[model samples]
Target: MNITKLIMVLICSAVLAGCASSNSGAVYKRGEARQVQTVKMGTVESVRTVKLEGTKSPVGTVGGAAVGGIAGSTIGGGRGSAIATVIGAIVGGIAGSAVEEGVTRSDGLEITIKLDSGGMIAVVQEADVQFKPGDRVRLLESGGTTRVTL
Candidate 1:
């Protein structure tokens, strides 16, 4: 191949490799913001049922893959390439959706705490609290609530 063609291939490979490693150090900050309070009064009036919403179905992945495959095939030459593209898309879509489903799930607690001021607040608590519907608890300001062990 000519030097120009070889240089183009090398540049493309470098760009793609860089793109692949760009998100290696990306991290997500989890947990809620902390709050400090001098005095707070609350009584667990009643534990309410908090139905956690199920994750969204991974329909987007399948849809995206199918769309991508069709777009990809258009770049190659001829009818055979178009057919290959559609098949590739169908396979990609199923694989992508499966991966998406594996990653999305429920993560926290849904609890309703009633304060002494006759005010009520609903929040997600830690899983280790072992709180159930009808459990009494005390709301703490440091992003946590203590189950009133009675």
Candidate 2:
């Protein structure tokens, strides 16, 4: 190959390499906000749960991919144009699904207890407990809210 053609190929390869590396190891943080509510101590009737459903739609994925593929295809034309667009759409859908999965949340439960002080303390409980429904428990209150730690 001529020196000019070799140089052009090298430049194109470097640009593509840079593009590939640009998306590597990207980290995103999602925040959760909890509201505190006060309750009086009462018998531990039942553990109540708060269900958080995933709001990501599969249509959103395919739609976003289709749009991105069209935009990508516009930049590359001819016999490879349709194929390139389809590939772009597929990649975009997978990326969108991953993002949606990261944001999806599930249900959490909080325990309610009646205190000897005649006050009710409802506490958010974590999974991994050896206690049953009728087990005697202690409530710890912080910032006007209580949690059953033990």
Candidate 3:
């Protein structure tokens, strides 16, 4: 029964891992300032919807393999249990990886901008804000990252 509970927890973890988005392409809060610099001034040239793939880590595969191997080991007798454990671990690893990828998918936006410096650039970020053509914006730099904001 301990192994069964362990398997359940791992399954839940795999599901949750796939559903998590680590704000790779997200917006910063208004009025929230950090050690910041303005990278550029620009106008929105276009906005397009895009998809952001979810995070993929070995955690899911390892967890699933452990659970699968433990569960499989409980079946049959002697050598049969060992064979089942290996098969189960293989199947579980594949299924867990696929699940993590599918669950973590997210929608984003590709924003094309025409900079005042006479250059064009595009940023793909989580579509949490509405942007339209001709909107004035600025590129804020914090650390090694840049964000486009009004």
Candidate 4:
């Protein structure tokens, strides 16, 4: 493939892979579809804004390396080209990881809920919906995962 096309493909693949994962409370994984969840009533004690970090998967790193190696191969001839390719790959890997993280990072919320069962617990999830103290909400629990919803 041509250099530009290869670079575009690599970038697109990395981005798509990163987007495939989610921490949103409203999104459910395939395995969670048929499972039952325990529902608990609660009052929102507080809602604090939080930052959700992105995926650190190898897709970004490998894609970046491939692109960088190709670009660097065009730099010079013989041993010099090979060395440039290695350096380029290393730099590209680091940059790709950072780009992936930035692109996939999302705003989240740390919610402190006072359960009606007389227990206090906190859950952090993507801030797709607004929450404030004193709002009535429900806690859905299943397979060691908990999500707060209104």
Candidate 5:
């Protein structure tokens, strides 16, 4: 493979990555105004790790395929080169999709809270904040999702 083409392919992959994102990592979306949420005081009972689903977008696969095809076409002449391009596209697409998933996947938490009012509830959200048992925390509820913040 041509070194220059390979470098170009890697650059394309990096550029395309910004086109795909998952709602898994951040506590809130940037630049979007949020409404006031219902706040409930509670004590952390337990905190456990959870996996946030990764984004599934065509950006990575398409970008990788394009890059790979271009790189592979440089490999030989005529029919053999065409075959290599096709094979390279297929393999690159799959690899790119896996890489995207790995990059977007996030660590989450399953927090069990004991509400001061005498009830137990669990909230699962991105583990952006640290929580420990016996910690005083606030449960913020809005938009059908709940989050625990210090």
Candidate 6:
């Protein structure tokens, strides 16, 4: 591929990577700051490794399609090139979505915690921290979001 197309692919990959947002328990969104959170004490009942799915965004699909179309246009002359471009774009779009998802997928943890209030709940977050059974943790809940932290 030409330098321009290569640059475009690199940019698309960068954008897809940037689209991945943190789901770690230690990370908080700007809106979550200064807001009151209901703190609950709990003990970890179990910890399991999990896979976090990646994002499917138009940026990947469109970027791939554009690159594919350009690459395909260099095929046979006239109508044949047009058809190739269309086919290439469709195939590239599907491949791009899959690539985006795979690239953004991350490891996460499913933590089952037993609250001090006699309730059992399981929380999943990015596995940036380790947890084990019987470990004391805090469950911070606000705006329907709950995070397990030590």
| Top-lDDT structure, candidate number | 6
Per-residue error for 91 in candidate 6, Å, reads 0.8
Q: For model 3, how does the per-residue alpha-carbon lDDT over 66-143 read when each residue is reduced to its tens digit?
A: 767777778788999899989988987777777777777788879999999999999877777888999998887666
Give the lDDT of residue 117 in candidate 2. Answer: 76
Superposition error at 90 for model 2 (Å) = 13
| Candidate with maximal TM-score | 6
Q: Which stretches in model 5 have alpha-carbon errors above 4 Å? A: 1-7, 16-26, 30-34
Candidate 6 lDDT tens digits, 25-133: 9899998899999999999999999999988889778878887887787789899999999988888888888888888899999999999999999999999999999
User: Model 4, residue 35: displacement in angstroms?
Assistant: 0.7
Clash total of candidate 1: 0
Model 5 clashes, total count: 0
**RMSD of each candidate?**
10.6, 11.8, 3.7, 2.0, 2.6, 1.1
Off by over 4 Å in 3: 2-7, 10-21, 24-34
How much is 130 displaced in model 5, in angstroms? 1.3
lDDT of 1 by residue, 53-139 (tens): 333344535554655475446555798778767876776566545544433323445566676778887665323345565555554
Sorted on lDDT, best first, the list reads: 6, 4, 5, 3, 2, 1
Question: Which digits, one per residue and each the tens of the lDDT, describe model 5 over residues 37-123?
Answer: 788999999999999877768877877777777767877889999999998888878877777777778888898999999999998
TM-score per model over all chains: 0.40, 0.37, 0.78, 0.91, 0.82, 0.95
Model 4 TM-score, all chains together:
0.91
Q: Score each candidate by Cα lDDT.
A: 0.47, 0.50, 0.76, 0.84, 0.78, 0.90
Better of 1 and 5 by TM-score: 5
Give candidate 1 misplaced runs (Cα > 4 Å). 1-41, 48-78, 94-102, 125-128, 132-150
- The order of the candidates by TM-score, greatest first, is 6, 4, 5, 3, 1, 2
